[model samples]
Target chain A: MSKLRPTNRSILRRLALFAGLTCFVAIVMFPFYWQLVTSISPPGQLTQLTLIPDLNNASTDAYFFIFRERNFGRYLYNSFGVASLSTLFGISIASFSAYAIARMSFPGKALLLGLVLSIAMFPQIAIISPIFLFMRDMGLRNTWLGLIIPYMTFSLPLSMWYLTAFFKTIPDSLEDAARIDGCTPIQAFSKVIFPLALPGVFTAAILTFIYAWNEYLFALTINTQDAARTMPVGITMFQGEYTLPWVETSAAVVSVTVPLAIVVLIFQQRIISGATAGAVKE
Target chain B: MEIRKTDGSRLRKGLSERQTAYALILPAMLVIFAVAVFPLLQTFYISLFDLRLNHPTRNARHFVHKLNLEQYVDMTDRGRSALASLSDSDVSDDVLRRLPAIGETLDRLHDTLVSNPDRLDQYERVRDLVVTFEPVRESSLRYFRISGLEANEALSLAEQLQDDVARAIAATRESPSRQLRVLEQISQDVGRSIVYPNFIGLGHYAAHFADTRLWSSLINTMTFVGFAVLFELVFGMLIALLINRKFLGRGAIRATVLIPWSIPAAVSALIWRYMYDGQFGIVARALDAVGLIGDSSVMLSTGSGAMVSLIVADIWKTTPFMALLLLGGLQTIDGTLYESARVDGARSYQQFFRITLPLLKNTMMVAIIFRSLDTFKVFDLVYVLTAGGPANATETLSVFAYRLMFRQMNFGSGSAVAVVVFICITLLSVVYVKALDSDMLTGHK
Candidate 1:
């Protein structure tokens, strides 16, 4: 009762908590603020000591420069191509595996699950050079196929994990009822179960696409040609071509990341849950 | 009972179900194998051999001592023509005498290579293929094995003869001609024909045992992961606890937390890089104002400073994910447990230590394991930020391997370093599984 009272001690504790939370929030949000500030600041004002840009003078010149000069539009197009294709491939393959894991009584199910989890954690560096070599030999290097296959491969484990958990929640009785009504197992899955699993599939697709979009090392190594490079690799390489042009670099960074930020904001709950799907379930 | 007379239709249905399950999983399994398993195995295999693309002689893995026929044939033909012209050269007698000795050395080389009729035939076949502008079909046939001793002997003899001829030609300064100089160049080409075997099994890995660079990079990697993850775990848990409460705008706060994570790592690196810029970075100026660091430039300029800057950047980027994970763990803890503790007159801190911390262990372990592995393989952040620069001080294992393999084009050494990274990752995985064996076994469901 004494501690619960609004005594000086309790007031100090409340102030401490608020201070901690404010610092945490500020630190978490400052980078985006800085990114935005740098993006809008006039090229001449980039080296200004102030953290915030002068609103009246802030210009979109850097953005126009990114599009007109750096060819970031092409990078965006390539990134979208790789990300969406990989997501489609990842979701499709993961659907069946998730279906089997969720519905079937397969031998080695545990082993398969363990293997998928391990693959999710496989370091990309370990296989990067080999993938480069193999792709070159197969004449796939610098092609979209080169980046998509590895992206799909790495995306499978996470997609499968998310989808399997989702599929488990759907009742088997619906599929069985469809079977009894004269639908084939595949038909039963497609008509009855597949519709029910949309949310999970969407989550997996979004996550996979984000993974493919944001993946750097594979995209960097696999696509040496400028025409084939993805956004992350493209933008990183932009830094090399332009010598520390913070305004233009920030413009490019904001353009690539703003869409993601907006999407995450709009779908905050879904994205958060999906991202923490593994840990939450455990 | 009547064996249930397994209904024919039902039996067929069951068989079809099993088949469908197999059919469903087949594509995913194939993709995983082709893209993940095969390359990993290939990496391991390649690391066992010396496969440097830069070296003319040992550019590829050689299972046995091999002489390059394309090289040998070209050299021998050039040598013979040079000798033919040199015998009639208007150079001094000393130079003319030297031509025969070079011819003798060339002859000896030809005899050693041609001693094995099978090889000589292959060599002749390769020469005809080359002359006809036909490509060699097999890498193996393109270079045939010679006795290591014989190859060494031929190499030295050709080299010596080349030097001798060049000296004699140079001595005939009065009769110096472009033809004599071309002869000197041809002999040098002949000297470079021997290709050594490149099978260095476990040699690359063996070399790392004493490799200081490898050790330093490994240490850097471990230090980065250890400090970053530890701080992330603590601060992440605190943030999770702070935000896990039912507060207004908590959803907005949660989304705000995810922003750093949603942004591409390369983008995050760029932002941090500018923010930490010595002259203009707001963060650098702020830190300097607060006296946390001596100056902003020192942030990315010094070894320890670069490492610190990187760790701070990593912590900033990843701690939110940690918080999200821990929040997931926090949610699973029953609200009633805290109410019951309150009724029993336990303080909040007491309840936290006894209840929340214990319940959050599994999720924490999983989070830490995942984050540690991620931090260990950190390449891009270090790459785009400090570039492991200011004297190789911040070079993590992955960046080190990238430089070796892609930059230096030393695939053999790079692959070897990659394998070392694989071993480190495996060790981390084993530790995680061992620590959370029962948790992992039960968590999948």
Candidate 2:
């Protein structure tokens, strides 16, 4: 009975905890909210220091401007095309290698794992100059392939790490059982293991997509022409010499962010798992 | 190749499972090599050469000092015109006397350079093609081999003659037309046309090691990484702890917090940039209203303010990610351990220190290592926000290298900077790896 009603001390502690947690949540959510408000608010009223977004003056002018005035649509297509292709290539390539690492007792396995992880840690700037020159020499610059190739290379490690962990979790007994049931190794993997590892595959897909989507430095350097520029590059270029035109930039920002925001929302748990799957133990 | 066992009459051989496994991984290995390792090796190679795309003559890799034939031809033509016109012009007695002497010297140098008729023909052909904006196919015909000393002597002599002509023109006290200035400029430019071999192996690296800008940028990078990761770790831990408990709206809180992490970094930068704007920024206004800052503009205007602003935004942006990782770590911790600690009369703080921290060490190490590396190579944030600006206070090594490589088009120096960044990053990774491994070993012990 006494446990039913909390004492003042316990109540105070709970209140304090709730207050702190709320503050954290608020801090995390506020900047995004501010961006939305600024993006929607009338250009003239963007400077107004209103605590709440003035709904009355809200307009989709900036969004319209991005789609109409700029070649942002082209940037959008390029970003999506490159990111999707990279994700496809990255997953297909990594899955095979990840499975081999998981199932096969291979020589130099540790070294191979170490190499992939080290590649993940490589600073992009270190190779930017060389890649720029090489890409130009190969006539790959300002093309979707140029961006996709590097993106796949970098994103491969993450997908491999996730898939390897997932594949390792599936018991070896399942494959042995499938073999006993007259299934070839390939048939067993495709029929049994692949279906089970779908979640891991999805995780890799989401993470890789986001990476190629968000990638700026490589995209900025490798693609100089307007048609080949990604969303990040396009939005950055929008901040031209004369004026920033914050409203249009914000609208472009929203366009780039909304699709990612939707993916995160829909797959928040999987995204979280994928992200922390790297740092945390299985 | 087929192998036969002595016990077996013959061994039917095809690709082994191990070979298939190797085959599966081969594509990934090759891709990594082509995209990552090959570029890194190429960067190292390029760093050894003196390659600048901007300079006309010294643009390509030069192993030996050579006179650029294209430049030599253009300068000879221009010099001939300048000298020939100078003799016809009304000038001082000193100018009249020096004009003929300078012209003769120019002719002598021209004659000496073109003494080989074959080389002269190649030079004239290349010159004609260059003047017509046609690409010269043969590099050998474009640059003539010349000793460094000879090139230097000719350059100095030409410069001295130019100076004398300028003085002679000034002595007349007549208004110098644009034509005269153009003539003087052409004369001055001819000396620079001599391309000296700029291949200085390990020279940029040597110079950069002592370079103040490099050191300062390194310091800035370290400071930013240290503070940003530290803040993220602490805040992340706190959030992780708070969210780890059973709560209503837990899913909502989890998803809401991750929005920042999900947003593109460049977009987040833009958002924060808007919020940190000196004018019309709600954050700046609010901070000023609360008297935390003397003025709103100080946030983005000053170096320390901009740094603080960036740190705050970064903490906000990444703490969720850190929290998510820590939360995953937290989930791995057994609840029964806490119950046992409580039964043994341990307080919550004592229980946390004893139970949570030691176990959480590995996760923390992993988080810190990854975050530190990411922050160390920070470019998009600093770039989109302050652009290493108000005077380069926030300029990290990556940004510095990017500026050098792209904006300035100094590939040789920029490649050196890139190499330095890679070395520093490798060192940082090694430190973390060693620390993590040692901690694990000690934990096991």
Candidate 3:
């Protein structure tokens, strides 16, 4: 009877906890929900204070304007192309380098690791002008290559640095066993090591893609032409030279942001784990 | 069987050797070298040339030359003498017609004066000499000689001298105290000039050290970063504590809390900017309803208002990040610590201060430093929200650099600003990296 009393009290405490957590969660998620609601609400009803819009007033006209009037689809393609290419190139180069750092006893290994990590801390703006001049000299200004090259500079450092840490976590014994079983070094890496480190690779890919996609200054500086501009840059075009069209701008914002939100929700666990793993591992 | 055994042994040796590591690392190193190191060196190289694309061929060799005010004055004196002699000469039409060589000499002299502004006083002296000849020709034409060949030649020479003197005066008038300022302005006009110039032994550092704007921005950045990080940490800790408890739909709550962090910073900042819009924004209306200010109040139009807006926007976006980090830290703390504290009759506040805080010190530092460094580099929020407006109240070092590089097109000064920011962030990173190396958060010895 006494144990039952404490158990019942605990259940009540848990119920109170649920209510508090629900409130906090609502506060946390309200902005995104608001974004979605505002994005879809009729132009007339957008200013309404209510959480839920009148279904009769809701329409996808804003989205239509964003696509038909703004050409947001092209910006999406540019962002996708730049981010995907950078991720692919950054990861492949980082993996091979990470593999060497993790497995082989190389001369100046510490120095190489130090250099890669140090470059990660450098502000991109410091080198922006020189890079701009270099690209112009090479006839790469306002081209995809202009944005991609600098994105690689920023992405490769962190990718190589983090990938190296992840590579170190995987046991070398597995690679050694593969080698003894008549696998070449490259074969052992691809067949055994690469598969084992897919989580790290995914983490690196996600981080690289997000970094490249979210970048603003470099993208703005390097890609001035509409053909090369990404979503963030394209969003600025919605705001004319002086006046901003809030309704249309919000529509563009929602379209560009929704895809990223979907990505985050789907990969929440991996992101959470990956973000904390290196920091926690010391 | 013998061939296979030999091949296996060779492969093992190759795998274990340093050569394989070099092979793997070489490509990345080459890319880094090509992309990062090469450009930096090239920028330095470009800085040494008097290479303005607008005026490409002027003083190309002496781009590395540094002249003092005295040397400039001497050069200007020589130019003045040459101009004076040419003005005073008596030559026939044919002789005067062959003076294109003298014209070329005058052009070179003008280039020297324009390129080197430390000689401005000397340029002013030359200008004075030419101006003296200007009225003499006009007076002589009006009174003595009207339309003769001799009169035309004298008037033409006087006009040419007058134009050259005026150009020299204009160049000198545009000179700034520091060589770097002149170089930066020149670089902007000539887009192909080096992005970051290293003028060795320049006193720009001293000048910047004395500048009040630098200190003010630094103090503002520190205050903003400190408040934002501290408040976010506190709010985040509370939220983490709430979420850590066993609750209904905990997974959903966790995901919801992460929503703010998931939104891109630029998008969130833009959203917040609209939310704080003075005319129709919900916040403006809410504030007005409470009589916080007039209905016509511009929340971002004043310095304090802009700062407050930035802090609020930052807290909203970053509290979730802090919560996520703290939650990870919270998970590592054993529940037994709380149980033990309760058993010892310690109050909740006591338990928190003694047990929770002490245990979370390193995690707190890690989170604080990371957030602090990030906030110090605050750009998108300030850029979108206020753009260092209302009399440059919100201009952080990063914004200052942006204005210099992009708006002003002064890459040299912009690079200097960037270097300063880099130093500040590097200092913070060093502390964090040290904390990371010591396994402070993991509680490892």
Best by lDDT: 1
Question: By TM-score, how accurate is candidate 1?
Answer: 0.93
Candidate 3, residue A49: lDDT: 48
Model 2 segments beyond 4 Å from truth? A1-14, A173-193, A240-243, B1-15, B70-111, B114-133, B138-141, B153-193
Where does the lowest 10-residue lDDT sum fall in candidate 1 chain B?
A: B1-10
Query: Local error of candidate 2 at A58, Å?
Result: 2.5
How would the candidate models be sorted by lDDT, starting from the highest?
1, 2, 3
- Candidate 2: share of reference interface contacts reproduced: 0.72
Return the interface RMSD of the candidates, in order shown, one decimal each.
2.8, 3.5, 3.4
Candidate 2 per-residue lDDT over residues A69-173, each given as its tens digit: 999999999999999999999999999899889987668789989999999899999999888887898899999999999999999889999999999999988
Model 3, B326-394: lDDT tens digits are 888888899999999899999879988998888787778778876787788877667777787768787
Q: What is the DockQ for all candidates, taken in turn?
A: 0.59, 0.54, 0.45
Could you tell me the interface RMSD of model 2? 3.5
Judged by DockQ cut-offs, is candidate 3 incorrect, acceptable, medium or high?
Answer: acceptable
Model 1 misplaced stretches (Cα beyond 4 Å): A1-21, A240-242, B1-14, B87-94, B174-176, B438-445
Error of 2 at A146 (Å): 2.7
lDDT of 2 by residue, B63-155 (tens): 787777777677667767767776687766665676665666676666656668776787788789877877766778777877777776777
TM-score list, all predictions: 0.93, 0.88, 0.77
Listing every candidate in turn, what is its Cα RMSD in Å to the true structure after a full C-alpha superposition? 3.2, 4.1, 11.2
> How displaced is residue A41 in candidate 1, in Å?
2.1
lDDT of 3 by residue, A1-282 (tens): 335756877778777777767677676666566666777777665456466677786777888988887768888899889988888888888899988887777679889877786676666655676787677778998777788887876787767767888888888788878877888778989999899899889998888888888888777777888877888777776777866677777787777767777787778777676655544443
